[model samples]
Target: MHPIIKIESLSKKYKDAELYSLNDFSLNINEGQIFGLLGPNGAGKTTLISMLCGLVKPTSGHFTIQELNYANHASKIKKIIGVVPQEYALYPTLTARENLHYFGSMYGLKGSHLKDKVVETLDLLGLLKFADKRIETFSGGMKRRVNLIAGILHNPKVLFLDEPTVGVDVQSKNAIIDYLKFLNQNGTTIIYTSHHLAEAEDFCTQIAIVDQGKIYAQGTPSSLIASTAEARNLEEVFISLTGKNLRDAI
Candidate 1:
């Protein structure tokens, strides 16, 4: 199968920055993959995702989503990809159903189709009973579930998620992971960034350890662990490759 996402020598550097955030990164993400991009703070994980999601422009290089180039087919590419950011992107005062409908409409979904999808997803995520509840009144886990539904109402072929399971309780984390797995099993290619190595080890079919805008290692979690000397888990492999220093950024 052809890669759903293809990047060739992709790089990104801010206008006023001294160094490149992402430098000559290239990789292919196959269809139906639960691909994890793992890294520490300021590792360019978010920068890469931002560029792919069209939230930022690449300083140089070429990349394509679903065979659609960002240069010529940006509009078309946007339709095929879903994004779930780390922060909540919902209206605080709006009811869950209202928020979903508004977001779905942005994707050109409307009428009974949009309404039905919103309700169906809410039900699937166990948020149906709270559909009419204001988003401000919902818990963090509940909001995350709703945020996920907003991005997926259009059923995007490739989903880009940043820190998806962060800040949630164990139960909420399990729920989110289960939903992602369900989506992946049903043919949605998932690309996500996370600090949760253990979760990524269990959830990702393949992983890439990125630092300073470059990939230090890329393979299945088990393979990475096996290849790293004295490493028994993803975290060990991560620290072995990325190191044991603080990656603090302002």
Candidate 2:
């Protein structure tokens, strides 16, 4: 089967920056795979993801999602991909139902169909009881769950998530992970970046370790563990490849 996402020689350099944020990155993500992009701060993971999601244009290189290139088929690509960012992309004053309705409309869904989807997703994520509550009044976990529902309401074929479980209680984190696993089981290709190595190891079918805008390793979590001497887990493998130095960057 053809890869769902194909990236080649992808590089990005912000104006006035001293070095490329992403340098000659290339990778292929297959359909139905929960692919993880693991890296420390300033590793260019966010830049890579931003370019893939069409939020930021690359200085050089090319990428295609489901055989559709961004330059020529941006609208078409947007229709098939879902993005759940680290920060909440929600209006503080809008009720859960209202927020979902607005986001669903962006995908051209309307009337009873959109309402049903919103209700179903909210219920599935255990937010049905809070459907009428304003986003600003919700707890961190509640808002995160709502944020997730908004992204998947349209049911896009490919999902891109950045730190979906960055902050939340165990219950909320488990709920999110379980829902993602369910989505994957039903055939949605998931690509995500996370600081939680243990979660990634269990959730991702394949993993890529990147630093300094380059890929250092790409393989199954188990394979990565076996390849690195004395590395018994994904975290060990990650530190082994990316190193212990702090990557503080602006």
Candidate 3:
């Protein structure tokens, strides 16, 4: 099958920055694969994801989703991909169902079709009973779940998640992961960035270890572990390639 997402010599530089945030980065994500972009803070993981999700423009180079170029098919691409950002993208004052309805409407979904999808997704994520509850009253985990539902209400062919389980409790993380796994199993290609190496090792079908805007290694979690000498797990492989130094930015 053709690659679901393709990048070629992609780079990004801020107007006043000294170096590119992403430098000549390129990778192909195949259809139905749970691809993980693993890196430390300031590793350009977020920059790359932002460009892919059409949230940021690349300074140079190009990429395509399902052979659709952003320059010409941005709107079409938007309809095919779902993004679950690290920040909670919910209206605090809106009810869960209300939030979902609004998000679905942005994707051009409405009437009974959108209503049914919103209800089904909320029910599947175990939030049906809380549908009418205001988002401000919900716990962090609950908000995260609702955020997730908002993204997938359109049933996107590709999903992009940035640190999908960063601050929540184990229960919430597990619930989110389980739901994502279910989506992947049903043919949604997933690309995510995470600091959680163990979770990525178990969840990702393919992994890329990036640091300083470049990929040092890319393979399945097991293959990556085997390729690195004396490394036993994804975390070890990560440290061995990216090092343990701090990457603080001003």
Candidate 4:
């Protein structure tokens, strides 16, 4: 079977920037795998994701999702995928239900079908009780849950998540991870980026440690851990390759 996602020699550089955000990056993500992109700040993780999601145009190279290239089939590619970004892409004044309704409509879902999907997703994320509450009234964890629901109400085939559990309580984090695992089990291909190495170790089926627009390593969690000298976990392997210097979350 063809890979769910394929990228070739992808490179990106911003205007007047001295360095490329991503350089000659290439990888294949198989269907039904939870692939993690782990790196320190400014490691080009988000740049890579944005390019794949059609949000950021690459300076060079090409990629295909579900065998549909963005150049010719952008709309079809979008229909088959979901993106949950780092920031909350939500309306602060809109109620959770209203917000989800609007998002679901973006994917061409409408009327009773959209409403049912929103209800089901909200319930699954443990946000049903607060469906009528405005986003401004919700806690960070609650907002995160709602944010997740919005991205997935259309049941996308491949999900791209950037730091899905950041800034949430442990319980909320667990809830999000559990939901993601459920999605993966039910045939969704997941490409995830996260700063939480320990969680990535436990959560990802495959991982690629990237830095300075280069891939230092890519393999299963155990394979990556075993390959790095004296590294007992993904965190150590990450530090071994990316270093410990603070990059100040750029």
lDDT of 1 by residue, 99-182 (tens): 999999999999999989988888888899999999999999999998888889998999999888888888878888999999
Worst window of 10 by summed lDDT in candidate 4: 241-250
Model 1 is weakest, by summed lDDT over 10 consecutive residues, at: 163-172
Stretches > 4 Å off in candidate 1: none
117-161, model 4: which lDDT tens digit per residue? 888888888989999999999999999999888888888999999
Candidate 1, residue 143: Cα displacement in angstroms equals: 0.6
133-250: candidate 3 lDDT, tens digit per residue = 9999999989999999999988899999988888888998999999999999998999988888899999999999888899999999999999899999999999899888987867
- Once fitted onto the true fold, the runs of candidate 4 whose alpha carbons sit more than 4 angstroms away are none
Off by over 4 Å in 3: none
Task: Count steric clashes of candidate 2.
Answer: 0
Candidate 1: clashing residue pairs, number: 0
Structural similarity to truth (TM-score) of each candidate? 0.98, 0.98, 0.98, 0.97
